[model samples]
Target: MPADQELDQELDQELDQELDQELDQELDQDPTGGYRPLVVVLLSPLAFALVFASWTIFAVLGVELKALLGFGEAHFAVLLAMPMAIGGLAALPMAALAQRIGGRRVMIACLLLICPFLWGLSHASDYHHLLLAGAGLGLGAGSLAAGLVYVSGLCPRRHAGLALGLYGAGMVGAGLSYLLLPLISQAYGWRTAPLLYLLPVLLVAALLWLFAEDREAEPDVPDPLQESPPRSPPAALLRRLACWRLWRLALVYSFFYGTFVALALWLPAYLSAQYRLPLREAALAALPFTLAVGVGQVVGGALADARDFRALRWWVSAFVLVCLFLLSYPPFVMQVQGVHGVIALHYDAPLWGFLLLLSLMGAAMGVGKGSLMRLIHRDHRDEMALVGGLALTLGGLFAALLPLVFAVGNEWVGIRTAGFMFLYASLIACMLVMVWDHASDRGARA
Candidate 1:
């Protein structure tokens, strides 16, 4: 039978099985709760957090790495971009690899493999060793995208929003790094900072492996709606890339991911340099921004579930506007007034402004993040591989540029240029989203 017919048959079988399960549960005298949804949701985050904590080691330790290794600003920028660059390259294969192994199994393997590299990195005597270790860390961390898919699959459709939101909260590891890693570095020095994370890493992995069940696989299952894999489709591939609706959704994801990652890697360094705060103090300032981002993910996930795509567009647009305003506020404040204006505002004005910007941006991006995934599901359900892969690839590519942009901006335009870049990016993103919203409406009406 053709692939589409096979798919239809599979769906029928799946539906039948689900019905049988439901009926069996109804007949049972006691419907003992197996794994509570709350347990699954909470465990997923804790597992995810361990991975993310390792994912952000370099970002948290950026300043220390620069000092210890005597790296130039440009080299530091390269170090910053490396993980995301590798993650983009690794995502597709990791997704496929997850299918071959299993997401939960692969995720556990990655955690085990990735955590040791953090220790190696802490001990790196030279740049070459650190770069190689970073590559290992990068490849290992790509398992996370696969883990997201796993989490999405585990939940029923009705609860996907809350489930994913819970998963995203694991990003609090980024915040946790800023809050804790710096203190570790201060108390124990940079050499031992990464090692300290080992305790949590081991604990979380052991817990997850014990609690998380493997997702069942059905190899002979048919997907009736799926077209047969094309032997030659060069032109089709090109057209798919150019699909207008797909591009619009990709744009949102790129910004949402790019914003989240850029900060995850750069915020600690930014705080330390701009404010001349000690590593520990800087971490505290950066903590709220990261935590706010985690909060934003939950908020965004909730909103995406409740609202229409049009409402989501407006919400995202408003979010970008807020980010832009927050980014530009300090400069705007300075321009309208003078040096005395700075004094009146006090020395901490820029820091406060940055925190505010980060809070708004993080939450906005979180909401946009889930909505982006939903948009892909809605628009290109059949062609998810091409669309999701390209969106993630592009997001990673853009993310690759951010550290360099910050480094160069600091070199040429002054340290404040980092804020200006955020401001500019936010402005353009807002404009494009508004335009896309209009385009979508026109297309729908037509």
Candidate 2:
């Protein structure tokens, strides 16, 4: 009996030691040799930026296409939004596949898939061809889901927010497109613009294939409570969707990220139509807004790493509310009765004012984008891929829907500011829900 008891104790100690070794390996820095993870962290964004640039190219060139195709505002809106709609549908599945097959593989596949589409876009002759190319272009947007999962695994949790933020700064690709597409189209025609993208996409895919390590290839470290009875990807996704907090975050993201995407696609057209600016001039004017978003994301990520996410959320929400309110105000002429004659007041925002307000709005949304992901990490670290994918999917879903709404609103109301009005209403709803959520949390604690 004494010998049996001693043998049991020895087996338990061996099990504990094995578990400890596995945990240490999981936490080890530079698991793939010297600075390989760092290389990935740096290079992944370049790949993502390239993909994002391709994904949003239609935004810059769609104006020419609209005229060429003889499409209405509604048709133009759908063309602008097609990539996002397809992307939203693809995000979850791609993210889940990244988890299983490895993000590196998934990301490479995304880039490869996008190449043919981009080539197709370059040669497209009709609206149907554009639609097909636009749908395929969505693979670039969906690539983000895989890229995020890949980057998240590369860095430690302490710096994950900043790393992800820097990676997300790839969103600057939109700005790059806004700046470059016009120049390219002017010089070489709109069709030639897509051909330029093929080189970068192919190069980045090669780099990733050669350098990036797959986290899935690492040995699994099992924690009974954390790892036991592993759930299927679909089951995990459904479970995450079941969380009320995920739904709330999805709504908030829809307002911020979705609005950002919609505006990015819509702004040049808006400026040309409303202010009677030439297309090139309008594209140039939209540049500051896109640049601000890129800078804001980096700043927001740093802030999230250093500060409380709840405080960051409050400040970001307030800023967006104020900016959206100001933006929603349409050109107005006010009249008041006077002793002499009727005093007349006409107030219209100049181009600079519009740029300034939109820049600030972009900054606020950028911060919100960075900080919100940190909150998800805090609450759902184990399920980051599922939750993050869903949040992005919802954001893309709104990006798709809001443009259609903007088109319909403008048509029905004959006000170009109708889009901003819709955005303002959405922000108000988000604020109310945020308040309710805070109150509920306090009640639960009490």
Candidate 3:
């Protein structure tokens, strides 16, 4: 061979050797490899459940606070949405830090940081103090960004959907809060409700520290970035954002996950006001929505793992669209002219009917949530943390904004169901985007 060709061949061999070493370093080498990954998968959701419960406790507590502070609906909306707004904006920076330092470390630090805030919330004496404490509680939302990265690294690509889906089920914590926080408040006092969250937060932190392995240590595969030159965190984030698909998915997520967060915060107040139900009964009625979301995520994740994602997305979207349409219809009275006499018709959804529709909507949103995460993994495996954070931030932004929107709509329209009309419109926009994207893809292929 020529001397130039020989040198090129030698360099290629050396590069291959380096790649092998890096892969070996990154992947787990345990004799019971599958067992350890399974354990991580099972335990991650429990920790996430704790984090999610703490993060969203404001929803349950806001009712009592509104009464205690004598705030109007608008003020109460802002108070309830404070954490999600802060958390959404903070997601990018936290995800960047997690990428640099390691998600496990980031997750632990977030859990610890939020503990003092939870303690403070329990002692908050005034509206300002509660706002401060709520802002602090927003720190717990960082755990989701870190947990997504950490769990993604542990599970194999084939099972990524299932693993993330199970982790997503931790959102059932929101429902649990509706059930437990009210009982706790009635038994101990509203002030004692936040104090209870400290136990699970600390316990989950300990569990993660003791059992969870760092991403580098858990996975045996080489980092995809090993071959590429390193970029600054900001640059890396910007690069990910440049992808139009990320933004598209983020918009879709804002509709689904955003609506979920908005409802989680708004439902108790909604039920009590619209249906004239007691506080406890309203919270109980909202429980099914949260439960359905959790169950739907688990089922969706498993199906995504076993089936085609495109089909799953279409089915979930269609189901949710129908639910939103039904939910948007406000109670009305109509008169019909007949040959014999005028007939008057009144239509109003019973509390049970409302709960049933909301439960179904929540389930569809949950499935879409899992599928969205799976799509992120499929398209941006290397940038999961950054992309996940971006997507979540957008969703959180919508979550934060929608409650205020709901409040404004209710104030202006004097209809309790005004929020559902907004949701219905938002879903219509999402469907339009989906259709355009689908057509664009087909045209390009043709």
TM-score of each: 0.80, 0.90, 0.88
- Model 2 worst lDDT window (10 residues): 1-10
Identify the runs in model 1 with alpha carbons over 4 angstroms from their true place. 1-33, 36-40, 220-247, 329-349, 374-391, 426-441
lDDT digits (tens) for residues 119-169 of candidate 3: 898888888887888788777778877887778877766677888999888
Candidate 1, residues 197-295, lDDT tens digits: the string is 788767767876777765556475667887976435566667766766667666667766766776677777777887788766777777777777777
How accurate locally, in lDDT, is each candidate? 0.67, 0.80, 0.79
| Candidates ranked, most accurate by TM-score first | 2, 3, 1
Q: Predicted candidate 1: what Cα RMSD to the true structure? A: 6.6
Between candidates 2 and 3, the one scoring higher on TM-score is: 2
Query: What are the per-model C-alpha RMSD values against the true structure?
Result: 6.6, 7.6, 7.2
Indicate which candidate wins on lDDT: 2
Cα error of candidate 2 at position 180, Å: 1.5
Candidate 1 versus the native: TM-score? 0.80
For model 1, where is the 10-residue window of minimal lDDT? Answer: 328-337
